[model samples]
Target: MKFGVLLDDHLFPEWRFYYLDYNELKRQLKVRTAANPQGKFAEQDEAAFVEILERELEKVASFRALKSDELERRVAHAQAAVDSILSSSDKPNETRMRAVEDELNKIATEMTELSKFVRLNYTGFMKILKKHDKHAGFQLKPTFMVRLAHRPFYKEGDRSVDSLVIRLSRLFDIVRTGGIRPPAVLPGGASQNFVRHTTKYWVHPDNITEVKLIILKYLPVLVFSSKGGKEFDPAITSIYLDNDAFELYLGRLEKTEGAEAIRIRWYGNMDQQEIFIERKTHREDWTGETSVKSRFAIKEKYVNGFLSGTYTMDKTIAKLRDRKQKSDKELDEMATLSREIQLSMLKRKLHPMDFLGYGFDHEEDIVRFPYAVLEVKLQNQAGSESPKWVTELINSHLVEEVPKFSKFIHGVATLIESRVTMLPFWLPQMDKDIRKEAPKRPPTALDLPSSSKRHLSVSPSVEVIIDRPSSVASTSRPNGPVSERTPLLARQEEDEEEDDDEQEQQKGKKSSDKRFPWRSLFASGSGTSLHIGAGGSAHPNAFLNSMIARENAGRTLQQQKRIVLPVRVEPKVFFANERTFLSWLHFCIVLGGLALGLLNFGDYVGQISGLIFTVVAMIFMIYALFLYQWRAHKIRNRDAAPYDDRFGPTVLV
Candidate 1:
């Protein structure tokens, strides 16, 4: 009196009651009732065949209580009792409906044999949460209770063929603990869809403090859980889909409150992806559009791979500007804890930031100069606010990728501090637009050489210390490391220094009319000083199409040897203007103890008395560059500028 396979609340019944094997349905109904060929045995034909099998076990309880033409009239009366017991039935409805679909596919291959024939026991295990991301929009799917659990009453072969793969365990279907799992149920010819912010998790309770509270409050890479983590192992997650060669699109979030964020918006350029607090309130604007500089010069001139690793040093950024605070249920529990932290950091594969760091223009290593690619742009206010000036990317050689949503310094700063705003925002924004003073340093073969020694796969001693004007660098450390391939005397001394740069571009084109001249202000012929001019005179015809300052002297030495900014010296040119007037009297006593310690404290301090005038402007720019290098080395034995020559130093370190 106990045969089962019933289902209702969106069908689930232990996969066709532990894959239909009531002794193989009573040995195929006792070989179709001992071959009943009118060889009658009437006790009223065995009590009307046990009252039609007790009215099909009173319609096997509730699979949504039958109907749908009573389950196609009980699968057409179990295919006319398997076509009146076999007797060579042709297509009698496809051999009696493929013998009742071979008994519902041997009950879906014994319910795809779960970890073991189901023995489960769980109760109310709970978890549910939501946060303030920057604003809010989340969405989940469920519809009804997925599982309640109390089955209790075993029988049929008393269950245990090696416990059939433990009933597809999510530790027996996770009864939540904070948030993120409830979704599955599709089955009947399932379509296979999946994707949701690069998730990763394992090590049970150690969600590294819940994935460092979603990378310090929602920057999310991914997250997911359905148990399976007791100190981490079997758990693995990856959902990046969209297929057809490469569609890879993902969008599903909910969280945002305090100072609100998420402004992405890019369709054609700025190459997209920058939320790390808009790279700090637009620190001189334009953040990520996804670029690595032709993928780090094609992984260092054609797949040698390895762009940056030991960058040393971290915080010198004493806060230029950044603020977001989090709210939309903390960026949806940081996109559900960055998919268990990129599958617990085993993470691999993201490609295309010009295919990782840089790679689009390889006519071959041989750096002659003037051919580059990776450009990306998208800084949003919305509706393509054209104050104009994308001029088909003015004078393109490419590699632009500009986005600039802002905040860039604090976190999401990888690819080694974004090769300093991708080639200085692809060349030109100039001065305290905070890459701090620009014209940086390094590269000098006559302030950047190698015009062409048959593009000989590079390194003729870096075309001879950036090519030549003559200081002493002979090339090898433009901020450290290089000098390996040596020979053909750097291609026969770079073909006698490119036949001396085509006889000095034919004597500077007969002394002054050779036009292609702005070769990035000659990459550094030492013309220096780009104080955004005409406001102080640089006149190549006064702001001539604006990155201003021209008529070459290497236009401030290739715009201060272009790495595009951060290195522009000036603390009143190394101090002394009377120790910047006694360092503004100790910067007004740390700006009155950081505005009364942020009006009498709030959390972990009034954030340290609201940063005591950023440690009194970096201890008055390091004791006014150490009382002007201790009175300019007691009036001039010359020594003080060095830590990469500028930037990180209020005093030193």
Candidate 2:
């Protein structure tokens, strides 16, 4: 039989057979099987399995047909309630909101119950088919349909079933849609006996988007509302607990099997009120097919006291220790956790090591469907990594090898590196000095070359113009090819008779004879050299090196002239500069705009006060701007000088 077609055919078929009880149904099936001895299901095993499955299917079909009208009515009513909440023109009152939430929760609970019944019967029938037909690959785990008795959602407080109801409803909705809209909202409160086996992969930021796409295609969202259902990674904060000697940190670093990392974890920013203090303990089973991770949660608020060595787990431990009252399977585990926490506090001198933050995203296949149910079994490698749904993510070209990333260790190391020498090896090292200034412009042929001259002097004013040779100059004319001949220097006439005497004296001096001393322009005296290199290129390296040297020397001279001040003056002057700028802005706005409007401000005391404040604010703002740059320059150049703060403006009001 084609199982898919058969399931679809009988999905909503009318219930033709009805019996009072299970025994009656079994008797009827037995009699029918005995009469049709040579029929398809005459064999004892086949008959028994088919009979039991048929009974389950019949019960579901009959129940649905009897309650179909009532179910429809309830659904419509619930939808109307939801619509009322969503379509409100103004914010609904708390009472009305609660009523609507309750109605939705009721509908969700009913739907989950219905789905559970259908799934149970479906699995049973499939298992029987696989047993009878060799070709049928429908062997499935038959679900035992046992409805859990309703209880309080929390041990204390409001204790409403709204949270669980909402979760079940959302999950059913996902199954109905075949996971088209992934449920992103997380189930509120702690999950009792929750086991978390995590495998972390460090991927490049550039590849995060692509990796997310692959994850979305293959794995269902772990939470119901991650980033408001728009597929953005969540921010996680973990306050890690440790001791003075960092025993836990060392154990983790050494890869100790039962080393526990205790932390208070919360999703989103620090504003999250719902927090969980958990101790994550991992152990590898014998077969190693599964790495067992046991997590225990404590009160979130106890984290501070725990670090301070004032908190005790006496109350909780007492509850778990009551073996006669409640022998929970997790009681021992909880007790162990309690003992461990206390021992660490007493023996290790435990304290809060660091509060670290990181962005986290999980990769897993968590969705289930009726026809095609997939459970990915992960085989552990030699190391700490666990099985992930998208194996491509773990061994992909986009990411490096699995990194030894511990948030606690890294955070502690960052704050006090002298204590923790073993830093995380994944971080890349960077060079200490990186060029911050714009690159110096390359020298052109027009630049004057500097000659070697140790001693130099300059007149108050000096001008040197170097033009290309006559041949090169003519080539620059309208109708000529460009001349390539290089020109060294051009002659100049001086008004002072001292020039004649200086020239006569230089004739005898050997220092003035060798090539033009370009360095002389930047002599010890007050003088400026305007070198007009109007022509051809010289030896490429010579003039370029000279220009660079000249630039450096000039910079050095300016540095010598600057006055430095104490580091405290930097911020003071910076604020003063800001104030001056704001004062100028005030002057422009109030005087420029207000005075232009020609309001009769002179007649009012308020106007007079406004004018006074504006003037005062502007004066300070202007003084601030000037003082900031001036102080910064002096400080940078290493010149120690007192900073001027006398004229600093005070508030007019």
Candidate 3:
């Protein structure tokens, strides 16, 4: 299950030298294996080596004219001089020894310096990896509470600290249809441009975004770091728009083509400053030959060659559809390069699949526009074979919705190349609003085609886009069944009419022997709700018709009884309890989030997003507690008849 394919890879053998040096250090000077010779080589070793070389050179000088016995005698003298230095009597001269030691130390220092140059460059990578994990999760403050305590004694905010950083998660496609190339063709032929590096938009606080670039031997593509991410590294509220994809969009401005430093208000603070990011800096030199005849001439030649070439891809959707078509031997050679191009595009935009490798070990069908290289497997009609339409009949059962001939492949290639060259120049205001809340997901084949200058709708795909803010909002309804809301308002109006009819029928029931009067004295206490106790102290006499009861109670029995009894309520105090539970949850969530930080070691940012959810869960629990308490109070105080069987769980108020 290959996620992408590869082809036409190029490399320089000179770069191999860096790898060789790194491997050597891994073997020799690595901390685990080597013993520390320390500073002696900086001084002593250099002086000793130089002195021995000098002695050997002098012996060669004497060989020109000396007798054999004389030469032997000179060698003997040199050996003695070396031996005497090593077996010196008493303390050696401090001046002489210090100079020699210093020279040796110099040599050792030189060796260390040389090693640094030899290692391959992963300059930024080493800084991030070795110093600190770039994607660690946050931890909250600790909490303490005694057992059986009524409340956790701390300000709610003390335990409710959220992470300072927002973790980006997997970017899902905001819009998708089919292929990376727009369903259109490039304006010119294949030779018009070879766009190695390009960018479509730039994020800024105000209008006038800038795109900068640097050319690499291999293309130095600009990846909008924020927009493209995997599921694990979702763009949270801080970075992404509405939890969709985001990027530090840096691209070329139509007016300003030169390099100049521009101030753009970036999203995060200094540590996370992602604004004013660079796009491709250089502009292609436009050739003087802008004639249509010249453009078509090269295109015709390409068509002729492609028709005969083995690498020609045939089929309408052959742009990217069902791309694993080469034989196993060819595929093994081509897969890596194809995958690299796809991954590069993902990074330049906002992304999702894991760049370290695919986000996971499974194949996901990604319908993104690769950087303008669609495979076409073209097969020419044989000279002695059956008729052309008969060959077509052999493939008759298969619907040729996607064209498979030479002409179709040429169109597909042209379309992709054009889109890449004309990377969208987004409206500054639109881009700003998009940056504020674009969507957690990344750009996809289905997103509004930037080349949406033509029709709104097309078969198999729609070129519909929000040209105005109103259009964006209006299209949202019925874009996917949103018109259902209008009927709900109508239903509410009908319900109001039914309530009027029911009101008159319930009016005619009267009291029998028992009297219940409240509207007289209080004037507004009409619903029979009465509270006769203060902090649980008073209640009515239970007896009826006895002399003592008659004297104490009112004559008509509608009045309150004078002889009162103590009344009490089973107290439910949970507001304080609810608060305490929240405090505990906050503590656990903070620590649990940080504990989850272990995943920061992974290549993608999505793993850190899991920490954010813990805090959200704690918040939701607190909200639910309020709902429960409100419902409990509602059950306790609702209206009910005296001594009725249906009346249950009422508090004496």
Candidate 4:
């Protein structure tokens, strides 16, 4: 059967145009054989590959069906033998039982091996089918069916078959969605290859919290979340390479914009397989042009060899050439630059200048926002260095600016501080400016323990150990000097501290009690609430219950506490109070009149409207009565003026 058009029409309609003929495939196989005698597929033609694939698939199916049936039969037979022996009236035979158990054990071991064999068979067939499918643009019928077909024969809840499908689905999702991109569009178009930007400041690590708070609003776009939901702001280790002459380091120190720094930076650990080698250059003359950073990754395995002067450029180029995934042009560009870096290291005798580490968190959908620290670095091909957005952001307190900050310089100074006599001649002035501008403690002087310290050796030839301070050494003391009285003294000190803490807590509790007026709210007095009659006293419980009920008094206590009209209130405030009650009275009368009018003349307005008017009238009358009582009490006590307003008028729309 010519499987060509039948499957190709459904799977890949475009395959017919580019599909290789059988003769062409045979010719390619011959050519490969001539080139490499022992290489895979060097001698085999297309027919041999197809035959092998078919035979493999057949073997997998036949073995699974036949072996599974045989295993089941053997296990069942062993079980039957044991059952027969046990059911018999004769005495149980130990030898027969042992033989039956041995047979059962052998079946179980074969079952495990069969399961693995079946899994491997499926995996191998799928892999081969996929490769051929890609070229032919048509998958093999049985292989495709095996993958897509629903397995009704498997036992319920058997997830063994489901795992492969789930894995494929996840891989598809990642390939479809996961790619490097900017969260938002840059000033220029998307085609820009490089963006130049400089650090306004490398913030003090002590102010990390403050800096985070400042940039909280911008973080939605600036930070990426890991699978564990942590904002990935990991410290990236950068090893700066410099020659013995210190020309690059000197130029950078002197603020020469043209000077460039070459470095390799990686996150977390140095044992990673991929690390970026970058050449960062700056230009001061170009307006708004801050810096240009070009970067590429090399294998981690090559890093040690390159540092030891064993790895050559030819080897690097050969590795690039072997990568079939990359294009010829890409390989050439990467190799050329790699060759230059390796050659420069050899000729100039480049050595490790410093190890710089900085944390960078970027906003989501980051197409390319490459910076070692929290500062922004723009890579625009146009070399546009205008930072209007950045400036506004800093001004808005999204981020604190650190002027003329370079991680390379900071790392060098901090690492070799004890060994070096004075700060670089130019650096002292910068340091003085920083100190003068902000006279706060900087975290640059942290005393880290030797075991946990992130150290960068200055030379590849020898490892340098920077000794930690005595304070740091003291903090990590594993075994303290023991004395007979030590445990007793420690217990005594702990007990004293606990007692002091308890006393402080008690003092605080007492002070809190005096701070708020709990007595005034629950107090039972004449001035505290409305009275039922002249010289009447009400209990606090009855008053609270009356307030909650908000209705006519039912109990004797509530009835006695119910407020009535009082005659001997202050006159000036009394008249104002009367006027306020009259206004509420007028409102109630107006609402009552409206309800009556709606009932008499507006039959067309509907029953719901008339009902609503009646309800409003009843509510207003009740509110007027409550206000009259509340105001009369306030006036009688002179607790608040009659003209004083507490609650606003309720307006119903």
Candidate 5:
């Protein structure tokens, strides 16, 4: 959809007047450009366009500032109420506690809307400016972008939003426990656990706010601050290193056993003196070892020298030892890691390939990621299950799971597309929007009042009628009565309700083609058996469709308590299987030769033993061939069944 239409669709009904006049600006540009028969605009025409653009920018800026202040006050008020309820000597009143919870919910909803408001207006301005530049043949975007950077509303990384999210999380935590806030986990606390499984998912920008609200109910946001303030910088910058062959990139992309990625990373900002030289090693589960990440911190001044093999970490280790800042074991480990990384860099001729994150001074290529990545790290005992909420969030429509997603690989693939032989599976998905229709959730105690329900019901894909008079439709739809123009909001609400009802009605209905479709696909070895549902039709790319099918199949297998292998089936895996088969055949040939020798050179008893040995040799050869073919078939079809044999080896012996 076009930006003009999308802007109108996602507009906050109560604050519609504050949005950019995108359509009007476009119409004005057309008229002004047409009057001048030449493509270039006259001085007066350019001035007129600039004047109108300035008005729109100012209007959006002022309104955003006003709304931001109002939201902050409301958050402070809610925080006070929460403290009162928590600090009371007696048990808090249930009604008061519920009221406080509702208030926080409203604040959170409004904050989300305000964020959307800022984003839509900023996008509108950019689109309109580009149109003006094209039609009038002027170079205005570069200068105007600088102007936009100075405006608070246009700054996409405004810290106020993060501050409000953190505060709301604390308040909601207090309300959830009825007076006690759960202990906050330090940012590095998860490192203490030796074994952890980290899964990454890409969150669509439209659903980021709602996703945060859902997670805040269970875990508090961890922030690092030097002055003990609520504000914290969330930026992390890293420079990935690789050779001209991109051996590290290929290794990491293929997920080869013992693949390693090297990078220099820093947190917060570029001015931070401390930097980490890190390496991530990938280990296959068949190796009976887990993947691990190791890093050692070094001063920023030594990075270039270290990479060039001029600086040694021995001096740094000695200084740390003398100061007693690190234990002897810790110093030794750091020294060993530093020496290994430096040697690897020099031997492999590794240099900077890509830069990730924000605000870097390097001359290397940098690519900004369009989507937010959420990493859920869990440290649980063996055979333990993930938390129910974590599982639910992963399955929800708000996020799309991209297993084994590597930032270095993505950066390299996107920045140096000409050099990359093959792109990652998730790269094709970038062209398509991952946002889906929000699922219908039952109302809870924290749900907003009826008057605010219309705001929550607006869908990103729903078309809203925007031609109505400003006076008649100033706010969201009312619950009491209806008017002619109000039907748009009413229809939206009704459609959502109808959707919920349809879902209820379809619970009992069954379709043979839809049930176990993945299983049938695996069994039949063809994509033709797959039924194209509305969701499947939306994603026309065959590769994306297959990925979705594999994910669904994996989820189903998980529900059945079965072992699941990697979804990606690389060609090397088949080669490995073939190699194993050849080894077994060689052993069988040796056994057959021994049986032949015994049969030819021995007496009757030796001949009888030779016959028995020959029979066993034949059985062994047959079993090995059969097992090889079966495993090859499974690997080709990308089956998720367990590959371990419980009785084959014992029975063969």
Candidate 6:
């Protein structure tokens, strides 16, 4: 759609007057150009356009400042209220708590709308400036953009928004848990067993604040700290390593099994001394192994020498060993990992491909990603099952699932566009708007108190959902080609409903022959079955379909309803069992060979000894086979039986 229409459609109705007059500006340009009938605009016409543009900019900036200040005061008031409640010796007032929650929700909603408001207006100003420069043949954009930068509303990374979000998250967290504060990090720290199933989604810039607000309700904002100071932003800068041949890039792009990506990453900024040399190895599902990520820290000063193969981690390992902070086993593992990484880098001739930084100074070959990547990581023993809230958030219209989305691949494609033959599927989708009309949510039981529900007996006003117009027409210009300078103003499809439907239909057809009895899973208690429509098909949204599948599968599993959750048996467990079995078999083989030697080339006493040895060897072989099968079964069934043999090994010895 045209910038004017888009601005009108998405602008907060209450603050509609504050937005730039994009249509009026366009009209002014048309009239002046028609009157002149020439390419160049008169001095008066140019000045007129500039005056209006300046006025619009001033209007937007003032409104943004006012709203920001109001939001700050409201946030402060809410914080004080929360503090008072927490410090009180008396029982907590239910009414007061509810009121606080309501206020917080309102503030969150307003903040989201304000962010949207700022973004739309900023885009409007840019679009208008571009148009004026093109039609009037005046170079006004560069100068105006500088002025726009001075306006805080047009700038990215507003600290006020970040601070408010953090404060609101803390407040909501306390309220959600009934005044109990959770720890910054759980007990056991890095040693904790976290087998999380991570999924990535691409969030449009317009929806980032709202998405953050929704996520903050369930998960707290995780802030990192270092010897430097508390790094609240937790920004990361990584230089991905690949060769001139782009072998690693192709491997990662194709998601080939055992594909490895190496990178030198640092948190906060380049000034930080500690840098992490990280490697990620991709494993296919058929291999029964999940992808793994491992990293070892090194000083920033040593990075150049290490990459050049002139330095090894020997000195670092020696220091660690001398300090006695790490176990001998850990030190060995670290040394081994370092050696492997160094060897791989040297052998493959790996070098830096692209620089990926977050909230930091941009350097050469840096490709700033347009969309915010939201990774939902859930730690569940049952891989398919997740918390209801997380499921809802993923299924919501706020996110677009881009499976196996890699920052490295994106950077490579964007930075060296001419070099790479194959581009990622999402490359074309970058221009498309991922926004959709917000789904109307039914009031859940947890939404409000009984008293609040009683007040909602009156009929609600009808909410008209406006569908955005097609952008293919609006983006076309009669006089000339579209400018590549303003990517933000590029044409975009309003939605992907048709494409999504076709994809879902194909998936449905493929799974039709072996459709799981999803309805039966939910039929017992509620006497209601989840109707997935004809052909057992799902909704257009992929996340929603997966959630439905998970819900069905979870309900079907009898263990899911149990009080205690079962421990998941990883593929490594089975490998460990097999290794033990092989060791036993190895011992048996040695004994058997000795027995045969004695039987063939010794006297009757030797022969008798050989017979006993052969018999013992046979027993051991049989025992090893039995143990392997037993352990395999236990692991497969997730049995809580003890795996260790307290006396078997002793007796055998």
TM-score of 3: 0.12
Candidate 1, residues 600-649: lDDT per residue as tens digits? Answer: 67465676656654566566656556655555443332224542325434
Q: TM-score winner among the candidates? A: 6
Best first by TM-score, ranked:
6, 5, 4, 2, 1, 3
Query: In lDDT terms, how accurate is model 5?
Result: 0.62
What is candidate 4's local distance difference test score? 0.41
lDDT of 2: 0.38
lDDT by residue (tens digit), candidate 6, 1-653: 35565666677778878888878988898898778968668999889888888888899899889988898899899889988987884566667878888887778778878877876776666666756786788899877866765664654346568788888878776665557775554211343122445677877656677777766655556554464234454455667899888888877776666889999876554487878888888765546777877778889899999999999999999999999978888788778888989999999999886432223221111122445677766545434455555567678777788877776786666445445666676764553456666634334222432223223222121111111111100121222112222222221211211232245553563364124322211111110111221111111234234435664665445222222221334568878998999999999999999999999998999999999999999999998998899887666555777987777778877
* Greater-lDDT candidate between 2 and 4: 4
Top of the candidates by lDDT? 6
Per-residue lDDT of 1-653 in model 5, one digit per residue for the tens? 45566667778789889999988997888788888889568889888888888888889999888888988899899889877876775676678878877788788777777766876776577667666776788877767766665664744334577678888877776676567654533222222113457777777555566667666655556553323344465445567899989899878876767888998876554576777788888876655688888888878899899989999999999999999987888888778888888989999999987432333222111122435667777765457566555677788777777798766676566446445565676754554446676524333222433112123222211111101111110122222211111111111211121222245433432242244322212211100111221111111134334444655666544344322224655667877888888888888888888889889998998888888889988898898888888997677555669865678889988
RMSD for each model, in Å, please?
Answer: 34.7, 41.9, 40.8, 38.8, 15.9, 17.2
- Better structure of 2 and 5 per TM-score: 5
Off by over 4 Å in 3: 1-248, 252-339, 342-653
In the range 1-653, model 2's lDDT, one tens digit per residue, is 23233333333223223211333433444455456645334455454655565555556555644444455566556556545654664443445545544454444434333332343333323333333342222222232111100110111111122233333344333222333354355523334343433434433222322333333222233442224655332344456678767777766654444667776666554455455556655332322333343445555677566556577666666765664544565666666766666676668776665432223211110010001001223433346343232353445543333234444554454334335534444321110111122113222111211111111122101111111112101111121111111111101001111222245544543243232222222111110111112222211234334444654566444334311111222345445655765765666566545543433455576566566656655565566567667765554333457755554444322
Can you tell me which runs of candidate 2 are displaced by over 4 Å?
A: 1-198, 224-234, 268-274, 282-293, 316-327, 355-389, 428-653
Which pairs clash in the backbone of model 5? none
1-653: candidate 4 lDDT, tens digit per residue? 12222123212222223222333333443454445544434224445656654454454455455665675566557556755765664555556655654454344334433433433333333334433544443445455444323321212122332232222222222222221122432211122125534444423222222333222212222221223333343234566888656666655654454677778766433355666677767555323364666666667777867765787556656665787756677667766767766776777777776432224221110110011135554333354433333444345322344455555554444333333322343232221111113222222111111110012121112211111111100111232222111110111111111222146654563453343212122231111111221211222344334333542343344234321111223355656766777887798788777777777778666455777878987777676667777876665443434544455353532
What are the lDDT scores of the predictions, listed in order? 0.25, 0.38, 0.23, 0.41, 0.62, 0.63
In candidate 6, list every pair of residues with a backbone clash.
Answer: none
- Candidate 6 RMSD to the real structure: 17.2
**Residue 280 in candidate 1, Cα distance off native in Å:** 4.2
User: Worst ten-residue run, lDDT, model 5?
Assistant: 464-473
**Could you tell me which 10 consecutive residues in candidate 6 have the lowest summed lDDT?**
464-473
- Show where candidate 4 strays beyond 4 Å: 1-193, 202-207, 214-216, 220-233, 284-291, 313-323, 354-374, 379-389, 396-400, 414-653
